[model samples]
Target: MPFRTSGPAASRASLPSRAAGRLARTTWVDLVVAAAVLVLLYLTLRVGQGTTVRFSTSQSAKVDTDPARLPYDAARSLLRMFVALAASVVFTFVYAYTAARSRRLERILIPALDILQSVPVLGFLTVAVSGFIALFPGSMLGLECASIFAIFTSQAWNMTFGFYYSLTAMPRELDELSRSLRFTRWMRFWKVELPSGAISLVWNGMMSFGGGWFFLVASEAISVNNKDYALPGVGSYAGAAIADGDLGKVGWAILTMAVMVIGVNFLFWRPLTAWAEKFKNEQSEATEVQRSYVLDLLRRSHWPRLLGYVLRPVGRGLGRAARILGTDDRPLTHDPARQRTGDIAFAVVAGGLILWGLAGLAEYLHDTSGLGVFGEPLLLGLATLGRVLLLVAAATVVWVPIGVRIGFSPKLTRIAQPVIQVLASFPANFLFPLAVWFFLRTGLSIDVGGILLMALGAQWYILFNTIAGAMSIPTDLREAMDDLGVHGWQRWRRLILPGIFPSYVTGGITASGGAWNASIVAEVVTFGGTTLTATGLGAYIAQATAGGDFPRLIAGVAVMSLYVVALNRLLWRRLYRLAETRYTL
Candidate 1:
């Protein structure tokens, strides 16, 4: 048999002859989902439009952080969130590329990333605020940037991890195709790696957006060492409410959050998901097309038309550039100029960081006490890191097996799916009262309280991803394993485990990041504040808020971000590499 080849035009075409059949099957499936989402959006938007919401007056102090601008604050917070999300995507792209292709680079990068991610949100707040404030002296822009950065801390890790997961878990066939073609790294990345990974990354982005909202109150409102810089945002308002124990305000806030989430899902995420599904290579015959009024309206609008016009030119330019850069199927001589440019960029960043470190050292020498405060947060971050690691590891072990088994059995998956969704949807705040009561009765430590909070927030990522991963395992693999007489432990160890490794990692990393958000609430509690605090990053943040210390809080957030970045670079990167090399089919 002679080798078969497609024409260049055919290769670049968006849809193939086989695609029509797949579309026929899937179009109706997504149409139904789109319709339901539209209905949900209508109800949420109608209910959320009014200024009046059910609230109690007894908790006025808690919700009074920016009493004069409640609605404005909420709007601002939402806008800032979008801004942070944009920044997060850019940052993720940069970091993912740096760590994915190069092993030697990854070794240094991953550990540093781990420390950044592990450090608490407060650690960053403490260090960054003064600097940001200094950058644009006497301007709200600096304050705004600080607040947005806080939101970024919550949102960025999950998105970055999503990209990382997609990059590492690329299908073996795709990897082989790229390798056989001898495609330049950029070509393989732009055409194959990115497109294949996009669905999962988009899904992660949607989830992370919601998760980011949950942390908005904590991130926007700064409290450190007894000094409070209550930025005008939803978070500051919510934090105030928590502090004052206002049930009505809390209820109102929760309602607002729900409405926003529902609206965002319908308007943005739902359509994107539906469209992304259309790109899948296979679809169940039973699947259907989705109908979306918003999308229908938008499809006829001028915006997409304008976007098409703009992007057409850019796409052409990029194509030409790729060719010029030697991204053809056959190998080409490496470009010394491009390599040198990259080296120069790296050198600049290194030099800038060195200067920053030197300046910090000089300042610390002037006031030894300043260095001592930073050390305190470092220790607190470490304690928090330990708590997060223990809980995340424990959750993974418990959830992976259960999720995989449920996934393998359709009936079980169907029965368990709704229950799992509900559990995951339940807010950590809902569990706090019970957690607090249980601890009070037992006179338990804050460390235990913090762990429980972190666990509750983080566990679902592992559970959900594991289920998705396991269910997505190719049917051919299942048959092959059965034919080989693989069963019980052997089947799981050899088949199920490897199949779901990517999902497990996705869950673990997201959960680890969620732990950071959960810590602030976990370590610092106020049920009329008989004022119990833990010896962790969360406690440090809570105490700082109480004491009104902003510098310490920023310091804490910095340490936390550093930890998270370091962890991903170290643990997550290693696991990703293992998956790509060892278990990949």
Candidate 2:
């Protein structure tokens, strides 16, 4: 500051031995988590492969089936899903940065994001299949590559939202500290934002995977209007068995899905939970410690050996380079004459849109596919719009009070969070057959089945996020409200409602997108080959996929996407802005 305090700053900056001790304690926890996960994985593989691990389901017309080879299938699916997940992490960071801090760019980003999310995964399959085939003609691997990209769409959006919320809601002091340091963009992102957002993003990732699994059957097993392509996967296998009413394979699918979910939770989630705990600023002194596996592994490993190697000449050289380049904790300064660029650079984005549009058009026009039979764009648009509204209303009405109640009560919040997490993780497709059975037995309209399927994923988005928002309300504000004798409707209107408004908006945004996904199953049902189809965009796209009409598929997707974009821009954006100004500080 005023006095040159640099001589003492180095001493002040150094961490004490106790910090090292605490770190070591955390490392031990990580190793234990890692070992448990590894053991579980090995056992699941063995059981899934073993001759003794056999089960049957009603889907196979009550016939018994063997699960001896499911280990191979599960392993393969898990590997691919993990790769897609990693890619999702990268996409989320980019999305979060643009959405949270960029003023003008956020305006464009939020709507564009809404559209991107609203377009169903099935729609991506329709567009991607033709593109991949063209990208690598006569290559079987090309088709598989296309399939994985479809999966990416399902996983990325929720992750993006998680990062967006974390960055936007970062503590004010942290914000000032970042600004004062004049940290480079990369440094700020890596050192500050990433840690803050990681826990929420990880949870969102888990939820996204659950959402993705709902579409797995349709994604892994490809079909467009009788031109069917079944890629070798548990999804394809499950789809095949389901189509033929192979109940035994259904049992195998259920078992495999359960094992994977539990295994993932134990391995990936446990360590992340531990690391995330470090980010919390305590309201009270240390009470209880949560367990972590990765921390354990980090401790027990040959860290000393690694550190010794790193402390040598080459490592010292690298460290010096890092310091010189302002890659360490130093501030970076650009020349005053060189002005900083505005966010996202709108001109660049416009150019990108043009290029993307051209590529899409070029692909569609060259194919010479008969896309006309898929029906009118106006009809598709109206159908999708109706479904979106219906689903949002349903989710809103159900989750609002539930979320508010959970938020205001700490004990209730803790209990509800885990329940919601489990429900969110359960794939919606698990309820599909049950939905169909109930509807049929009750003589309910086929449309109700579609709504139920859509609600399955969309409802959780609102419920869970609402609870999160509620639980996060500052203790002081709650106390002030209580002291004022606020209760019932007045309490909700002034305190609870305003407190959770931002989260409610986010939940609505996510729920609407989920509705689109739910439509894939909801609008197009194939119960015993007597398809009960809804009159909507989803049905139109489904028909195109079944018919191999790529052009019509693109048209349907485009129309639906445009509608989504328009609604988000005109309606949701206004609501989001209101939330930001009125509720968020």
Candidate 3:
């Protein structure tokens, strides 16, 4: 048969048959998914209305052991994570873009970001809880909001750094091309800058999620002014179980968390990773695009086709609206006089505020304790710094090689990626009891145990970034090295280490900051009525917070922040500049 031979009658005749074929191809899975979605919507509504379960402040502090309740608890916890992730994304775009684009903003914003990143997750909770509680007095929603914000604090900073770094480090050719095209700031952001930064942003988002989990337990089981305000989630459940010394419940919580983390990676992050590869500026000749079965299934499904058809008009309308929103047409130009005046004014204002804040804090400390009180906290800061350096050094030695090996092999990466993500997401605090037991049994010092705990939380930053860097190495370069008979330590020293150095620096910076934050929890761990205290800034901060000694806590936090900012300025910033100029691939 000659198929359709271009006749109107022939096309009309084919329409019915095409429609019948489509109908015949509809599967049971689609129907099942539709039903499941409906049931989920119903459940969500019920949960929101507090009809199915009450997540009240009073009830949130208790631990429930009924296996059947685990699903609801898990759902509540995951909801907070998703909400916080959404907030983090919004924050990353605004904060990172603003800092990256404007040199004037960068001066203030970059330093502010560093300080914020160094501030402990617990510090955010302490500050946020009281305000949130006052805002929504005696309501569960306020507590939930505060918990989500705490998680946001944990997740936002590193993701912001990733985006800003990516934007600043964009290839010169791409920048020239965008300028040649005469792209407005908005157009350049949409068409060039955002796409260029997408891969790094996605990878960092995954890492941020892991950090969110690390703090979720503490955030959920919060105490403000010695008053417990536990929210109904797996975190609070685990915290209560640990407090009550219920090993069985702890095991169950661990299992549930494991399942949830694995499921999320498969359902969300895996697909995102595969999708973001298309946005890479330079695609290697032999680099295989990462694949996700979930993504493939969605592509092949009829639902996506129908949804796209339905949303096409809406998308076009939005595009029109975007174009109507005015973009800056003038080319960017430097105004030395204006810039200098702005800088001077900003410095004056900022210096005044800082001096005023410091004076207030000093007076407060003097009135309560004495000027000499800062001496102990400053000494503690040094002790914590030593532990951080040791842990970061050990972690880099162990994880970088393993990350490179896994990243260079696609088969290995596919097999190991999800597993590593799951491990990274596992809360380090959940294992505190086991760590304490080991320390007691071996008669190891609490200081060593605390360092190990901090390392467990922070080491993944190095490993994940190393893998990302390694995987990005061009295939042609690898092949060229192979043809030259490059192998073993020689290959690593010349090829891999240099290739991954920039990423290693990025990871190290974040990991160092994270270790500082992890210290607050790690330095003062109490497991099953056994307390282990390490004498450091983290311990000082934790003890002060626990005892409601606001003056001491503020002093400890101030000292810790000073150490972090100083180290970042004197060490990491210089390293980062070197990486930007010399080591970037």
Candidate 4:
């Protein structure tokens, strides 16, 4: 038999089967749920439509750098990161879920998302600050919201991508089981698919959260109309210190960020990792199960039980609501002509809008800088592309082995999570001195320095994702390999590498995106009045940013986005197909 191409719908059952489409059970809980669902839908409709908030950022922002305020600053940054992370989760659920459900939407949405995430945090920050400040005139809430939104952009994309892949690449048997269960879409989502993707979501979410900290300076420090604004956070404090050329204050800020990152990992991510281990897709439980001290403590407490008891009614109500809503499993009529027509319409509208935006950009560039501006950035982009490819490949070589060891050992994972997260969350600006020192001492150019700087912030994407993938390999599969006398290189070749290939691809793509963004800051280095610039797209963007040349910035960003998306489509996608065919869980 010829090789088969398994599309997303081939292995997943978010669709209604004949039995489920016919009838479902009824109860008072169901009635109450139905009523609640109606109320929710009404509220959603009322809130879904846009309401304009006035945009203004005339208010001057400042940060106080008292060491006494370190705790407060750390708290603010942590709060923003977590809040943004929460929002990212909601966005991932809504955005990725919708895209996954509809092939028409997926075609447009996925590509758009690739472009969106490729936009640098600074690019987003520039536009968001003014709008958010205007929305909440005379209130600090605007600045806070702006910071949170910037962090959201940093954190959401990786998570959304991971979840989208997980949904589509679900195992064939599980998809069949879901359809056979007579599940309505809601039931399918909550009971089957959601649980299925839980591991990927949690792990990827953890990575995104860590990556958000990499852009803390960009998020917390703002500049508009030649005016500098700094939010009261560790990031802004560090930025201020760097500006003042005070290494002491910078060191203190690094300490604060490290504490915040490691503490959150212990309290939040480790516990989630331990909890999500139960959801692993395997017939036999792993011999070494992940454990977390925080989770163990919580389990040993009465608080969780009490809370569960208190929220039992709410849980029941939601379950009932899902049952009632899902009972209507009537499948939509599949009219090929109409479907094709709708797809064409969607493409036309989406393509027209994109082209319109591009045309506007081109017109602006033509008027101000001329279309010739694109030439340098394209050449610079190729330089950056080489660096990015090398970064991903090198990081993969370094992290994969370590990630495997960490993921396969429950104790080691629990211990390493905080340490790894702290390292990942460390901002590159704080380490500029080290890069500069090495460059000066070794006589290496900014080319090598660019790679070093890019790796500082982006390597964790590969490490954390590889760990997630390694942990998810089925226990039964391992045992089967062992029983078949598979060992050492053969075991790795046949099982380990293939099992983690999908996750590695996910990690590699996100890491590449992070590296591209990091390049803007990485390629152009300045510390102690010594500035070193690499000849790359990143250097062009950095110089444009410094000069406050909006046109150059736009061109650089556009070109950079094009490069990132091209890499994603041309390279990572083939690995995605391989994972789908050979290693899907």
Candidate 5:
């Protein structure tokens, strides 16, 4: 009636203007996000209620692998992962903050973290499950607590490392600027340090989440002391499928997991990456910025502002707590005597903790076994160590080049992001059958195949960290490299390696630890009742776990922890210092 355009050309020309005019900035997206979030909370709460229900041993062995239950099971498993993630974040912030602020603590905490990272989830599961079950007798909540803790151990260590690196490696210029501004420690932490490390935190948090997923089966389908504590989840569903030789159910689990992973990536991480772009400390805008529709919609909506208003009192409370805790009186004092006293006190406390732990461990070993308690496990650890080192080396050779290339091209990264995430998140157990098949078909030994399986589980750590490292290299520097005609090996030698070295150290350390843990899963493989065992510490640990042999599990875990700590202290620790001190941007 108003002579509106109806022809194809006119309609096409008017579409954008009409769409823009018709779009309500806050209405639709706000409603959608609110609805989705509320629904999710409801679902999580509904699933969590099952945690307090009565439990029985027979229930664990009778996981119904029906495809119909896959969605509910997936939701339950996802809830566990999220709860563990929340705990891991809390641990990372507190632990890394303490260690970063205290030199003495750093010296102790870093090595302790290395040892903790090397302790396999099964090791924790074996001990934690019994204690938790005793604490909450005849209830599913205890098993839930044990499972969440297992997932937390898998996630917390590398995240702490990332945050610690972030805090410890702030640019000199930023530190000086904060000094010039006479910033309080809390203000500096809030304004400069946290923002600087936010990117690393997000990326490493992503990696940690994937690691949780990689070991989800172990966490969800647990067996301690020959009592099946397997909870109702996709993990138990899949494990039961594998045991029953039902490839079809396994396929369903895979599909369900894929959908869940993809949904989370698109809805959560992609948006976070786009939001994090504002925190980048570059001289020029990135050549290609990350974009996510969810982020865009949120930015255009009024909900964030509304929510901030509603949460103001909570924010103030947190701010007051931060002010009290983050206050450092040390900087105001030039008294060397006071500093020395503090140092002495710190050392005494740390030494006492170490001694107490060692005494208990020694006593336990004494009580558990007679002779050569740790000797065979130590030797087996060396075998596993050989596999870890070799596989890490190989993964570096393969993934570094690929990761660098991917990182350099934002478009390629955008296209490949989900693919890489899925690949990393796919649990190693799913692929065990393939490895077992290869071994059966080719007559290759598990000793060699074990390395491959470990690489499969652990290599993503290297790749993801390398990609972050490459992306963080200043765009201005790359342009200068181009202007100076830097090409090929020289480009990599001069710009790439130095730029990525610090990140590579972080990645390599985490990757090696992941390989150490993966050995427990990889060294022992089963596909449809056909089992293969490799001669390594991982197999020793796995066998002990299956048989519910507590003393043997502890022995294997302790030796593995010692080997990992020694390797980190001797090799990776030195490399870490070199990179942090010499190769920073």
Candidate 6:
């Protein structure tokens, strides 16, 4: 040894060299992360300035289509989506928890959510705009809130269903344990219910985010009561480009949206998805864990460590505050008589509201064009239903096998998951020009082309859920199959199909709803001065909205809602029950 360094003086002398060595060892990841941070900071500053200047006056104006302003516009759009997603999460927890925990509440809440889910994207925007404007009068913030709420409607319902399903499906043993421990409501939610439901919530949240993107154009480019309102965003950019027949701007907007979607998948979804796997109730024999380099970097980073150290006291103080505010653990006693009376009252009120709504709808339609007008809408509904069923069948046949193959392989899943997710989140309308062009060029029927477009937006639901189901299959079951030499169609029919049936049903329900929603945008495509309208319910609703025919719009939406709810109750619900009884792991 040259010289022993043991004293404080020696340690102090080594610090500079150690720091230099560590800095030298930094990889390209660090540089990339640094660049990203700087870019984000610049964008934030630019967007902040733009917001103040743009919203200074109360007048609503058209969004600019300048390529240079695209970044700021995209930032604003993303901010709205993020805000809406946050609100959806809060709503999902409260709404789903209530529905799951109380039988009395569940009777009312579940059907309410079902009807809400069936409500069209434009319906939400049409109903919400005036209320939101009144709430935040004389400010751009009001329109912003309305836009966010529209996106929220697209996102919230499925997430609520996911959480509620997870909660109700919790293992009996876990429920008994919580009750035996006399856990406080907060404790039960935080420690038991939340964790148990978290994986489902995350998956549904991803799907909801994708659904929001599908409706982004409608939400941002608000057209209600025959008046068009445009916000500065990629959605508005695309809408304006389509209206002007500017293919160049449309191309640019598409590219920008793709980049943003990829960035979001990597930065947020990848890490969250990896983290959520840990919350799954069943253990697998697979040794390899889902990995996220971003998450790993943050966990090991020096800055995060220092920040944690600084905030340690604050965290402790908050913990103390939480304990002080915590509620008692005692279980509440139920009165059967009171519960019965409450149920009866709720039923009466609900029945009255339904009858009143039907009367109003009938009156409005009669005043406008009479009940004879219902013929066209009912025919459109049947056409759309045929397309939905056909597309769903096609998707199931194609994706189920592919999804299972990928899900069963860790290496493949690691590679393909993010790509599939980003693709799913891509707004289907971005391809409208290409689709319209193809149909126009090839002389194909617009009806066929429209159904394909609808399928593109909806099929990912089945794919992703199939993957989730396959991944959840126990290793022991797989091993047992292998040992028994079960293979080919026999193995699939006996094991794999049954295992994924529940997930497939969940996905199918959502996919069917999404297909219906997508019809609004996909059924009618306009590009480069060419317009194509497919004959269906989507076109019907789109026409009504465009013409400000409120009665027709409401009627079309109601018919669509009825179809969706009826299918859920008659078909999917039965399948779900079968899955629970026979296939649940």
Clashes within 3 Å, all models in order: 71, 26, 0, 3, 0, 0
C-alpha TM-score for every candidate? 0.70, 0.75, 0.89, 0.86, 0.92, 0.85
lDDT of each: 0.65, 0.66, 0.81, 0.81, 0.84, 0.80
- What's the true lDDT of residue 403 in model 2? 76
**For residues 28-61, what per-residue lDDT tens digits would candidate 1 score against the true structure?**
4356655766985775455334312332212222
- Summarize candidate 6's per-residue lDDT along 288-354 as a digit string, tens digits: 6678878887655444444555565565565466467654222246677887797899889988988
* Clashes (candidate 2): 26
Q: Pick the winner on lDDT between candidates 4 and 5.
A: 5
lDDT of 4 by residue, 347-399 (tens): 89989998998899889889998999888899989999999999999998999
lDDT for each residue of candidate 3 in 1-585, tens digit (9 for 90 to 100): 665555877775665566566557877655655675798788767666542233444453555666677888888888889889999999999898888876767888988888898888777888888888777765777788899999998899888987888787777787779878876566677788888777677878899999998887889998756767777788888888778778888898899999999889898888887787677444355556578877776666555555555565565665566567654322256677877898899889988998998898888889998888889999999999999999899999999999898777867876887898878888877887788888899999988788888976789889888887776677777888899999999899888988888778778888999999989989987778998899899989888877777878778888888998898899888988887888766
In terms of lDDT, which candidate is stronger, 2 or 4? 4
Determine which window of 10 residues in candidate 3 has minimal summed lDDT: 51-60
Model 2 residue 502 distance off true place after TM-score fit, in angstroms = 1.8
Error of 4 at 114 (Å): 1.1
Candidate 3 residue runs with Cα over 4 Å from true position: 1-43, 50-60, 302-332
lDDT score of residue 289 within candidate 3: 58
| Candidate 5 lDDT (Cα, 0 to 1) | 0.84
Best-fitting candidate, measured by lDDT?
Answer: 5
List candidate 6 segments past 4 Å from native.
1-61, 301-342, 367-369
Where does candidate 4 clash, by residue pair? 54-134, 55-134, 56-134
Q: What's the true lDDT of residue 385 in model 2?
A: 78
- Locate the minimum summed-lDDT window of 10 residues in model 2: 55-64
Off by over 4 Å in 1: 1-76, 102-108, 131-141, 169-187, 224-227, 231-233, 278-310, 321-367, 370-386, 401-438, 441-444, 475-491, 541-574
